[model samples]
Target: MSWFIYALKNYLNFSDRARRKEYWMFFLFYMIFVFVFAFLDTALGKANSMEEALDLEGLFSPIYAIAMLIPSIAVTVRRLHDTNRSGWWILISLVPVIGILVLVFFTVLNSDEGFNRFGRSPKAEPAF
Candidate 1:
């Protein structure tokens, strides 16, 4: 819970480092929110067809994602910073088949052993 809020609090902050825990925890809560909204949209809307239900889901789904977009980008950049990589590395995700794999690899890699250009180790202290 605190992790989720911390991510939001720094929503626009792209500088500094973000620990793996901070990144993954925020994503966990974000996914939970998306699932809950999807469930509600489906159950309450009572659409007549699959298409209609999907439309309802689409209507509500974008809201959460849109709200979180900046924070998501900021955290991903910070996460790259933690790994001692330029935030521009995130653009690798634009590549075809291997793009997502490369991004995941970047995120999962251990943070730099010590400080680099970005900042000190996020693991040395809590992200918040």
Candidate 2:
């Protein structure tokens, strides 16, 4: 779907809010490609040395970075939705180790009431 492609195009973008569906869908796409590439690399070529396989791992570096970034960004926005704060709160993680852990906890916490500041409540079910 275009959503998945859009996510990939913005792979390196850290800003801009993302809806839950967009995040999950992109993740689904990422996993599919990861499996495909890993399988193809292993099946088509024989890397006799550990170093050779290590080289293949390098090929995955950029994709891995995006895979990791998308979820982080999505979760941050969802967390902000819960607290009624803006997604910018994610920047708190830059504070230090403790901040990172706290943000993680906050993000994983339950979505807040009807709505706060980051638009409608994330938990609200859509009619569609």
Candidate 3:
């Protein structure tokens, strides 16, 4: 839970490194919220079709996603920084299935031990 908040607190911070736990935990909670909101939309809201269910009037998922967009991008960029890669690496996901798989591979890997161009290792910092 703290990890999720930490991610949000640094929602605009894309200029540093994010340890593996930070990146994954944020994503985990984000996906959980997305699922919960989708469930609420379907069970509590009126919608005759799938399109309507995703429309602005039907569910909280869209709103939640919009709210999370920046934090999500920030974390991903920082995760790439942790791997000693540029934030532009995120655009690799535009290639297709292969691109997304590559980005996932990079994000799941552990951070660089010391530092690169981005900043000091998040792992080297003391845990709060």
Candidate 4:
């Protein structure tokens, strides 16, 4: 829960590293909220059919998606940075199925030890 809020607070920050836990928790809550909003839209009669829902004719889900878009991209870029990759790697998602798969593979990788170029690893314990 705090992880999700942390991501939102950093919604526009793309120059730092993010822990895997931070990235995944934010998306987990993001998906949950999307489903909840979709359900609310349906119950409120904003969406009358599957096609309407899929098309984002509903009020809540689409607005939620729009609001989350920047934060999502920011966290993903930070996640890529944690793995010592350039944020521009996110452009690979445009390639096709393989592109998205490659991005996922990159994100799932452990954070680079210490740091390569993108500042310190988020996983590192603070020096006392």
Taking the tens digit of each residue's C-alpha lDDT, what string does model 2 give over 1-128?
Answer: 67676655655544443455655666577667656655555555644333543455534533555555765465456545555567777788888898789776665555556655555663465412
Q: Weakest 10 consecutive residues, lDDT, candidate 3? A: 47-56
Error of 4 at 74 (Å): 0.2
Taking the tens digit of each residue's C-alpha lDDT, what string does model 4 give over 28-57?
Answer: 999888778888888889998645754778
lDDT of 1 at 40: 61
Question: Which lDDT value does model 2 have at 81?
Answer: 57
> Whole-model lDDT for model 1 versus the true structure?
0.81
3 versus 4: better lDDT goes to: 4
- Which residue pairs overlap in candidate 3's backbone? none
TM-score of each: 0.87, 0.50, 0.89, 0.91
Candidate 3: give its CA RMSD in angstroms: 2.2
> Residue 118 deviation, candidate 4, in Å?
0.9
Off by over 4 Å in 1: 46-57
Highest lDDT against the true fold, candidate:
4
Model 2 spans > 4 angstroms off: 1-57, 67-71
Taking the tens digit of each residue's C-alpha lDDT, what string does model 3 give over 35-70? Answer: 677667777855444456555455587788889999
